[model samples]
Target: MSAPTHTTTSEPFDFARAASLLTDAAARAGAAIMAHYTGGTEIEIKADSSPITNADRDSQAIILEALKVLAPEIPVVSEELASDLTASLGPRFFLIDPLDGTKEFIKKRTDFTINIALVEHGRPCFGLVYAPARSLLALTVADGEAVEATLPPDEAGADLSKLAQTRLRARVADPDGLTAVVSLSHFDPETEAFLSKLNIAERSSAGSAVKFLELARGRADVYPRFGPTMEWDTAAGHAVLEAAGGFAVAADGTKLRYGKTEAGLRNPGFVAWGRKAGASHH
Candidate 1:
């Protein structure tokens, strides 16, 4: 039997419904991840020297299965399955990072997360980031409606509405000083230089999408990354941050866009801000 598909229609896509589906998928993936987290899994190195584990594959499989039933027509560009990054990607697609912080996960850190997002015309319209080990779920339920909830990874496909949620909003930067969230595993000299240019009063290091969560939750004012990253690594978090009244941009101050097929889906250095500060800061 053929897999089910969501029929294409002229009617607008229901983001709230889609968010529900994604939340369930993410929760399922989280459960799968925690299984490996507790049982322990072996790691292998990819051609790029990045690490991969069975947990990543298991999570990817669960999410891909859910997405297939959700909207099969929309091609999925996932980190684990993307062998050809230079290939053309149309205006809309689903992006997935089954595991965003492989290094941290291998190190037994709780900062890793599962990321899923819908990119339309190079902008992420919906996104979900779930840190299973942390029991933290952050996502955009609808346009301009972002929230976080406490959800244990063992709960398979739990209904999001039943969980108590905290609305997310990025805090404005303090004129005198800013709190910067930097990469814990991928910190680079350029990121240090970028922070130096700002009147930063505090700094914290975190792994994976957790950095984005900090800004979304008003715990940090900015996140700067000069290291290389793939689209899947940041799209979902970017969507969440944008929904929470924040924005991300390249070093040149232009908006960060997805579907960079020519660039091999690789991202340039970018900065995420709680609020768009003056150009002087960038």
Candidate 2:
């Protein structure tokens, strides 16, 4: 099935169809990652000191090839291949992180995910996050519509239509207190200070796009990060959150935008809130 090219036509892109197609692609990538997860795989450190394994490359190959058949006209900006990338594509393109949370994966944790997102006009319109280790899949099928499902843990190639999916909606924030999802590996003082200002009743620690999944599922209230992050790292999760009636913004509270060519595709610090913006948001 071919996808409608947003760059060449006036027709509205078929987000639901695209989400289904990409979820399969993400699932295939997940299987490849799981193959490596079970064994002792050699790791190589990137120039930025981030780790990469053969699993990452294998997953990238699978997703990139799948994107070609699914949406040939749309260019993809993927994490494993964008080390020296300094420019954006046209108004529409794909952002892929074949394997997010490498640290968690390396530590034999279950928080890693495969992230895929479509960015149009500087905002993510469609997104998919598949945590293969946990058999959890989350995605945006349309504006204000996101869904989560549990895939068969051992069958990454399982039929998606057979899975039971639950619609996701961010819960309204409680005025008295809130539940915050914090990064398990990258916690810092700035995040601590930010959470201190809010009436936080509890804090849940997680890695990768799982934090966004938590908020999108109404399991958490807010997620904030002051540390550096790349666009591919957050776009898919941001899209899922937005589709579930949530929002993510830069440090100044403006909506987070993609395609940062001048910034080398790096993202500024951002805050994500479920349902509504925080009254005390800066």
Candidate 3:
């Protein structure tokens, strides 16, 4: 496949501008989520059996509006609005999981996140993952450079005033004693078998895209997923992982690509790692 084309105008993408937009969108989404959260709204099950709440709708609306103003020409495929235009998407688009870990959100676990990615030619070129409850935001571009910011502790939501930024890079561990990050919500037999095949030294469980953020921050070495996921579920996290000197690939030894088919946007099993040998082992 050809490399994905970025959405650039006469000038190159302004990273600062993009980050600013993302931060603002995240803050607005966070506020919307908090309102629903405090109201104790009842949750409904979607057609796929996934839980949805007012938080999901309000957050998605905020994000969609912000992105339209920031990059109006770019098309977006958000989880909340995917069904409306799944069949009409072109080659390049934005894949968004406006509120990931809805289950966690409904349970008030504070592990949910707002995810967005700029996908071109079926690959993510820029990504943003924000955990508003924790005031953590991760952003990355295509060239393996990522940064994280922690917002200040404020009752208001995603306080921009408390932006403490830091560059992120993966830690190189001993190839023999690698660690793996697994999701606390979805663990299947296939993932267990895959883990048994490796000489894993430790295992950690996290919620939503935070697992990927752990790997990107060098706190974890590998993350393997054998169960079903959607393109929006992993696109932003995948871009952040790739930009932090890591890659998420199919268990069959291929780079994980997006925009599979009209039947659905489900993603196959994949592994994410910081080292090439990790991919080989999987």
Candidate 4:
């Protein structure tokens, strides 16, 4: 008997395809969240006493299931479900925050977001942040291209490929022209003290990771975060900013990296800056 011949034609890695899938997954999660947003937003307290809504759980389920199909080989460390990020993660993994701003969500604010990112070698390499209320999506497709896009206002026929795309650019801003974006609800004096030293031209406040977008788009120059945060909180936003030619750094000026198991997924005080925003941000 003749030996059986193997004819396998595997496709090359498709960055665009992966990005589209991730974006579509975010859209689905967004829809899941919207369903609850329209109904009663019953709130539950986590061990941390932070708010958790049905929307968060529902969205997490949608994203996690999609990720299983999208990249079954990799593990996911999601904020709503993961108990230990370091113990649960590898050099390559997915990090997600199904609903990043639950307080904002409860308050009926649009700043809440759905975060998804791929972390490799302690760096956020690709990510997508979908603001379902705003119908905005931002991502990097592993091509070093970061973009902010919009799906159709109509959610039912959402298509990531049909997204209107605008490549992001972190514009240069000197100290005198710099505007610092701070957390609207969590801003502390330490962050204010840090910003004061820069003498930034303006101060603006917003909730959640949307500040990352402000920096990535040149709408703002710097973000000083001095309070507690988690890896999932920043990873997706960090990937988008880095791909847009900007960076986030600790107060000590070390570039922020992911998978800090010792810290229990918590992040230290840090400053995120746009391209050429100046050394003061560090």
Candidate 5:
């Protein structure tokens, strides 16, 4: 069967509804993570050497169920389920990371996140990143459209109704200075050499998909990854960054696309930078 179609009608973007659902989902996932965080759960390695826990599976199930209820028609491609559905997706779908930063979570750090992105025609049209422990939610819809909200205590469990909205924008300090964001966990020697060549002034280290959020909020300038990442790892972040006048592209300058192959979902090394960087670098 074909995947369900996403709504294109102009029926007002439901920021409130989206926030509530995402916050609740994040909180639910967070609780699961906390349970494992106390340190009794076993950890197993995926073929890629990534760690997986009961928290990841439980959280993914929670997010998947919540998303289905919130937007039943939208198809979902969550990291936990990608292997099963990767070959069957349609033009538009939701890319989700239920427990992004499982490594961090296992380490008892608060760097994990719940990521959701709306991908249409191989590009993200909307994106949301929820960090449950921090009670933070970052959202971007289109160009000049973005909001950062905090989840309320009362509705912390998938409540789609109590998110307090706040505005967010990219921070451009020098406009000419090269600021780069590199991975805190996946940094490599080659990526370091690349940044050195650019003469970057400010460097930021963030875990999970929050690197994309940093770029979206203008907190950092550029992100260059020479290693590997799956489509789900960067799709949502790419959407938010693109909406904020930034983009994540292959090192060769092609826009990142998803649903390519199953043998390897690892993405090519890419550079993410703002509109100004495009003029100077690309």
Candidate 6:
């Protein structure tokens, strides 16, 4: 089914309820990931030689099943299941990256995560990223409310009310004193050249969508990703940052758009930054 392209402020889309359901869904996926994390799952080679495991497959299965029940009308585009699925997608769709950091997950690092996003008219309308190994969960519906909470031991039965919620806010970047975040797995010279243009105070590298988390939480000021990326890789993070009053813009200073049919689902260079970054840093 086609998704709604726009909603008025009074629209009946309940973000809290969506966040609740996504929390449970992500927690389930995370559980599936952790099960194989310590249990030693076999890895297979994808066409690109990237690592794939039962954890990735099983986690996507759980998330796709959950999303089907949550929003039956919306289509789903998942990384692991893409091979068997068709390429055509609706204006609105659910995107999933059951295991975002395969290398990190394989090495038992805590940088891995599970990502889910709802795209409407080429923009992220809802997003959730759960770092199961790190016990951190982020949720946003692009309704001007974004939050990050700790996943309780019983994530499946987490008390949505009792969860300590921190409303995400993007802090202003002192351009000359900014803490820049970069990719840990795929650092390239292009990114360095981009950073040199900025007056940065420190540089940090991380894996998966955690870079978005840093910006949303007001811990970091900017994340300039110049290397290759897919639509799924940035959609969830983009939604979360937007909800937190931040932005993900292209090289030409335009907001990032999704659902690229011509580019084969790949993304161009984009900079993820806080709300005050553009006004103050530029």
Clashes of each: 0, 0, 0, 0, 6, 0
- Arranged by TM-score with the best first, the candidates are 1, 6, 2, 4, 3, 5
Tell me the tens digit of each residue's lDDT in model 4 across 127-213: 888888888888897546799987533344356767778999887776566788999889888987887778588888888789899
The candidate with the higher TM-score, 1 or 3, is 1
Q: Model 1, which residues run further than 4 Å from truth? A: 1-11, 277-281
Tens digit of per-residue lDDT, candidate 3, span 1-282: 233355454324455566677777787787778777767877899997998988898888888887888778777888888665447567667888988999888888877888998777777768899887887889873346788997522334453335777877877656688788998899889889988887889998878998889888888888999888889999999888888878888889788988876637778889988645444544
Question: What tens-digit string does per-residue lDDT give for candidate 2 at 1-282?
Answer: 333544553446677667777777777788888989997678999988999999899889988987888788888999999966686477888999989999999999999999999888888878989999998999887766899999633434555577788999998889799999999989999999999998999999999999999999999999998898899999999999999998899988887999888899988889998997456555
What's the TM for model 4? 0.91
Q: How do all the candidates rank in terms of lDDT, highest first?
A: 1, 2, 6, 4, 3, 5
- Cα lDDT of model 6 by residue, 143-198, tens digit: 86789999942436365567788899988887568899999999999889988888
**Overall local distance difference test of candidate 6:** 0.82
Pairs of colliding residues, candidate 1: none
Point to the candidate with the largest lDDT: 1
Name model 3 segments beyond 4 Å from true: 1-13, 84-88, 152-162, 277-281
Q: After superposition, how far is residue 281 of candidate 4 from its true place, in Å?
A: 5.0
- CA lDDT scores, all candidates in order: 0.88, 0.86, 0.79, 0.81, 0.72, 0.82
Q: Estimate each model's TM-score.
A: 0.94, 0.93, 0.89, 0.91, 0.85, 0.93
Output the better candidate (1/2) by lDDT. Answer: 1
**In model 5, what are the clashing residue pairs, if there are any?**
20-160, 21-160, 24-158, 170-217, 170-218, 171-218
lDDT of 5 by residue, 1-282 (tens): 353333455434354576556667767776776667676578889876788888788888887887887788778887877666436566667888877888887777777787887766676767878776676777763334667777522224745444566566565546556678888899999888888777577898878888887877778888898887887888877776776777777888887777665535568888887655335554
Residue 158 alpha-carbon offset, candidate 3, angstroms:
6.8
